[model samples]
Target chain A: MTPAAPALPPALDILGIAVFALTGALTAVRMRQTFVTAAFFALITGVGGGSLRDLLIGAPVFWVRDALVAPVCLATALLAWFTPVRWWQGQLLEWADALGLAVYSVFGTMKALSWGVPPAAAVLMGVVTACIGGVIRDVLAGQPSILMRPELYVTAAALAAGLAGAGVVLALPPALTWAIAVAAGFGLRGAAIHWSLHLPAHGGEE
Target chain B: MTPAAPALPPALDILGIAVFALTGALTAVRMRQTFVTAAFFALITGVGGGSLRDLLIGAPVFWVRDALVAPVCLATALLAWFTPVRWWQGQLLEWADALGLAVYSVFGTMKALSWGVPPAAAVLMGVVTACIGGVIRDVLAGQPSILMRPELYVTAAALAAGLAGAGVVLALPPALTWAIAVAAGFGLRGAAIHWSLHLPAHGGEE
Candidate 1:
């Protein structure tokens, strides 16, 4: 079965990579790491999960196959280093993070579907591809994974992938499905960040 | 191609599981975690990767399918908690670890080959299954992975798996191949742990 490509504009992909790289650099700054270490972290955070997924699926890794990603990552790291804005500042970084989440979710879902994985497995791949990089970054930086918190992060990605997969199953046009899914993810995450929305605490003893 | 089953008695499997669980518990104690946390860490470190591999390969997870593994793990954890000897300093624990590494590597390779994976991929799977549980434990504990260290752990597993795969290709008797492979792995890892052997550091300044 031919995998349907998502209707992602090239600009969206580039934006996603750049934003994730910036987040990585910002995380490094918080950890008081050197510039080279920051850059290395940024690159890995931008591409690591996709690389692992590609290796597992026997697909040509996009980072190795295409030269554009590396340069974009480096540029983003440089930008993060020189920015007057503190990495922890709420507004700009949050928006960038939301955008990255949306785009990465779509990209991951599309890639997994292309590999002929079943819809459920493909949705799993999508969530993993979008979130595992950040999880790895957090682990390396010795912080709890965002998923461990009562955040809507994984939930947002899951929603996006589920919608995309549903659309595919319903025979919707690929472009329309992708656009709606990405919008749904970005919209939900953006609102959560803006309003500080979160899941209710379980209040159980740890 | 038929995968080779280890000639080592089933008792070794029980012993390996117990020792690894003890190691996991000791490591958790070193972190000064709570009992529930320690037990969770022990269980995951004892079985997570192999369980994941079984799920992927459509095998009944040994822990879930067989009645013995859970009891063995629970007993190991209890022993670690109550034993007068410091778990970390126990010589039998060291021997059990070596034996576990050998048996698990052989078992992982055989399972992969049974699923008809390519030999190289089977070898990779073996290394992943044998060592990934420990990696997951270290990551959760905020320690660097064994793979990041200049260690002989993964290398030993890979070599054993490769030798076992070669034996399969050469049509050696399954039992003989398993015996030799297990010995090769156990001897290498035991010597490394005994002598503090490690790979030379790489990625020096160019």
Candidate 2:
């Protein structure tokens, strides 16, 4: 059987992997962990959600098919470990994270669609793939997960994925649908970050 | 088509759920978290690995089909929260943990076998399903996972699962095979806990 082509361009996937690795390394740094620990964190953050998604969907050769993702994660981890604080405290990292979120969300949805999952399930899978790494990172780092926070994270992902799925249903071109999804995800997430917008808190006492 | 009967006795499954839930509640207490956090942890610990396994095998109505699991988890969490530490500590908790590890390991292996997974994969799944909850709990509590430690934890589960798989290959009675596997797992874990025997630590530079 012919090998399946990747759902997204190599460049965007690598960028997303690198950004996630940077985030994981940053988390390890905050925890005052060693270099190896930081690398392990970065590796998991880059691939954990996607690994789970593939395993659930019974994708063949789950990790091996993505040649660029691991190397990018490793490089980013090393860079994060060696870079000075002043260099990292910039808007570039934030932008990279937004881009990563968008790319990963779209890619995740496309993979689910390829698996022939229903549209609703595909959208849910997209959100899970985009947010699960961060959720795992927070949980492992002993911080409250973003899911537990009154945040717009899941909502943003859902909106992005819904748009993409709708595009698919409407028979829009795949490239155009992906572009629209990525843009929407990035736009909403960037706005949330800029405006400090969050979901309304529940009133019940803990 | 009629649904396949559960592989084990309903009471045993319920007992396993309760034990895991109790362990999770105790962990939450150690972390000094609120009741909600305790409940959440307990529920996840009781059901997380099994839910994951079912999803991977494409089992329908994964959590909904298991009626006893959720209630047992909730009940055990409530019990642990209310019970005095003096009453719940020492041998009582240890015994419960051993039984839970054994039962859950066998349950996982049986499920994997029914799914026609290879023996090695089934054993791996057994160990993962039995122990992933504790790993998740430790990670959430910001401690090293049991798997990362030099422990006999996974070894015991693997041995038990291997024996069970062999029994199946030889066409031995299923109940007898399950009993042997459970005994091997629980016995080894109990002995290790009693004797404080563990795998040797990796030598680190001073």
Candidate 3:
């Protein structure tokens, strides 16, 4: 079950990684950790999701094979380190994160499908690809994990991945399919951020 | 460079997994989560380290390929769920965790070496396999991650993995090498548990 084409163009892929890396660096900076810790956090956050996907799908880890990825993460870390924390204060980072989440989910699902992972699992792989890096960052930072919350974050990724999987199953053009998937995911996440949207708790605790 | 032998015999491998699964299950039970949550926790914790190792080394994930592993994890979760929490409140579980940590570290290192990973990276892989599962569990449980603490836990796994990597480099007898590695690791962790040992903070904060 080969995917019709690559899920993301190279530039966009790098952009996604860079965006996630920035989030990771900012996280470390907020904690007042040193440069080395920020760089480590950036690298792990940038590569965490895709590496897990490739590993699960029996492919070489993407960053290990590509010389450019690590350097890019390090550069992002440097940028974050040199910049003052106040420069990044706002919803811009959150918006960037949403974009990264959408694009990465599509890329991950497409990659999984190409590797012959079944469709359902492929969708899950997409979620893993988009979210695991942030999860790792949160966990390592000792922050409350995103997984424990009932936010619409994972739900948005699932929507994107599910649509991407369906698009491939229906043999749709890759460009249109990815565009719709990313837009839908980004829209949902953006709305959630703007309105502070959340999924209802199990027992309506709130 | 193919390894001279499998990292562990089938029985011991399953035992290690079962022990880890028990810890994961107990964690969820202690948190008052549902049976499904407990089972999920058990499965992830049981297979997490090995899966990470295999993914890093580009091997098929062990539990995914094996039919018996999931059922064993589910069974362990059931045992944890059905039994009273008082039955497991002691050092016994900690000791079992140490044993699992030791055995899994050695097994992970040997497997990485078999996959032709470099000596140092293989040792790191060993630590990842032995510790990442519990880290994930703690992260999900909203507990202070073990990574954030300067405990001797990771140090012990590193010792075991380092020894295992060294033994492989020296072309030592596999059985004897493994026994010694496991004993050393378990001993360190056991001593830490009994004596409340800790690594000094960066600035001697303790």
Candidate 4:
């Protein structure tokens, strides 16, 4: 089944942020932190990756310059607060995370390229954009980061990012390349989620 | 007692990195990871905050483009690997961390100012420079970040950064302000280390 490919600009961005913020808020709930802490967690997780990307690529940080970003994150936190977290769990959460990861990976790579960053670094920037927010969130919550797991998390991002980079190098159309990259990334992560796919733990040693 | 005011460029930079790397490696040793992991931890903690600052300020990341930076970190890691961590414990490490923190806070603020970042952000840039590397180290090592501790860690960074920003805004001489900022940061952190000073936690109501 083809996941809906979101091609819109700021809306897609907002959706991704809201989903990630929801996840961060859920984590705060698990930690028994206050609503203030939940809002902080939501805001950070929502903006964290793009902020890191903008910083690295020497662009004005996306959230800092945008007044609406904060409101969107805060609203997302409030939305999560009033809702039962069970509503966000299971396949729906996984699917949303997969989409966010894929889209952000593509967006980050494209932005880095626009900034004249080197190609390889641009690819890595994609992974950074999709992952670092959760790393920051997990660190703050004193939990092991999802990246620390043996899963296909970063691998999925890398596939999307690397493909986009290669497509750029090959002079592929931006629209087509983005579509392909997102689909591939989402597919990989979806499979991992369903099948519990993971990298070998400790060099496959006993 | 006055800490050594080493004004040399690159030497001071290397010294700061090496000391920070030593702390990262010691964390790894405590975590009982392999030497390679220790080296990875050392390199990341040494460069994490500066890397973050440079990225945010639109400067080239220092460790990325520089040859010496990696070597300094690796050498420090190797040294830590060979030494008994007990040798690194007690007051000496605290002193070194304090010195590194102070110097980095000043450097970060100055760099942000040079990049034309706003005054408040520049002050925050200072705290980010000195403290973020340790936060990253703590997170990667699966330990609660020192940031979560009720202590003067960030407060010391803020004092140095804030004073420097104020001085710059007041059109004070750079050298004198830099000296004052570093000294004040070092003194505050040193006092905390010596006296076990900390911020009040959660009303102490339990």
Best by lDDT: 3
Best by DockQ: 3
Predictions in order: lDDT:
0.72, 0.73, 0.84, 0.81
Give the 10-residue window scoring lowest on summed lDDT in candidate 3 chain B.
B1-10
Better of 2 and 3 by DockQ: 3
TM-score of chain B taken alone, candidate 1:
0.88
The Cα RMSD in angstroms, rounded to one decimal, for candidate 3 relative to the true structure is 6.8
Report how far residue A19 has shifted in candidate 2, in Å. Answer: 1.2
Give the alpha carbon lDDT tens digit for every residue of B1-206 in model 4. Answer: 22222233978889998888889988898888899999999988899998877776566777887889898899988998998888887789889999999989988887777766667667767877888898889877878676666567777887898898898999999899989999999999999888998764332111
True contacts kept of each: 0.03, 0.04, 0.14, 0.08
Candidate 4: TM-score?
A: 0.61
lDDT of 4 by residue, A37-150 (tens): 566578678878889887776676765435466667778877767776667666898799999999899888888887777889999999999999898898788777988988
lDDT of 1: 0.72
Tens digits of per-residue lDDT, candidate 2, B93-133, equal 87888878887888787778787778778877788778888
- Chain A accuracy as TM-score for every candidate: 0.89, 0.91, 0.94, 0.93
Off by over 4 Å in 2: A1-6, A65-67, B1-47, B54-110, B116-206
Clashes by residue pair, model 3: none
Residue A23 error, candidate 1, Å: 0.6
User: iRMSD per model?
Assistant: 10.2, 8.4, 6.5, 6.6
Tens digit of lDDT per residue, candidate 2, span A1-206? Answer: 22353456556667777788888888898788988888888988888778766654446535667676777778878888888756877878877787777777777777767766566556655765777788788877778876555556656776687788788888899889988988998898888778977765322222
Greater DockQ among 2 and 4 belongs to 4
- How close to the true structure is residue A95 of candidate 4, measured as C-alpha lDDT? 91
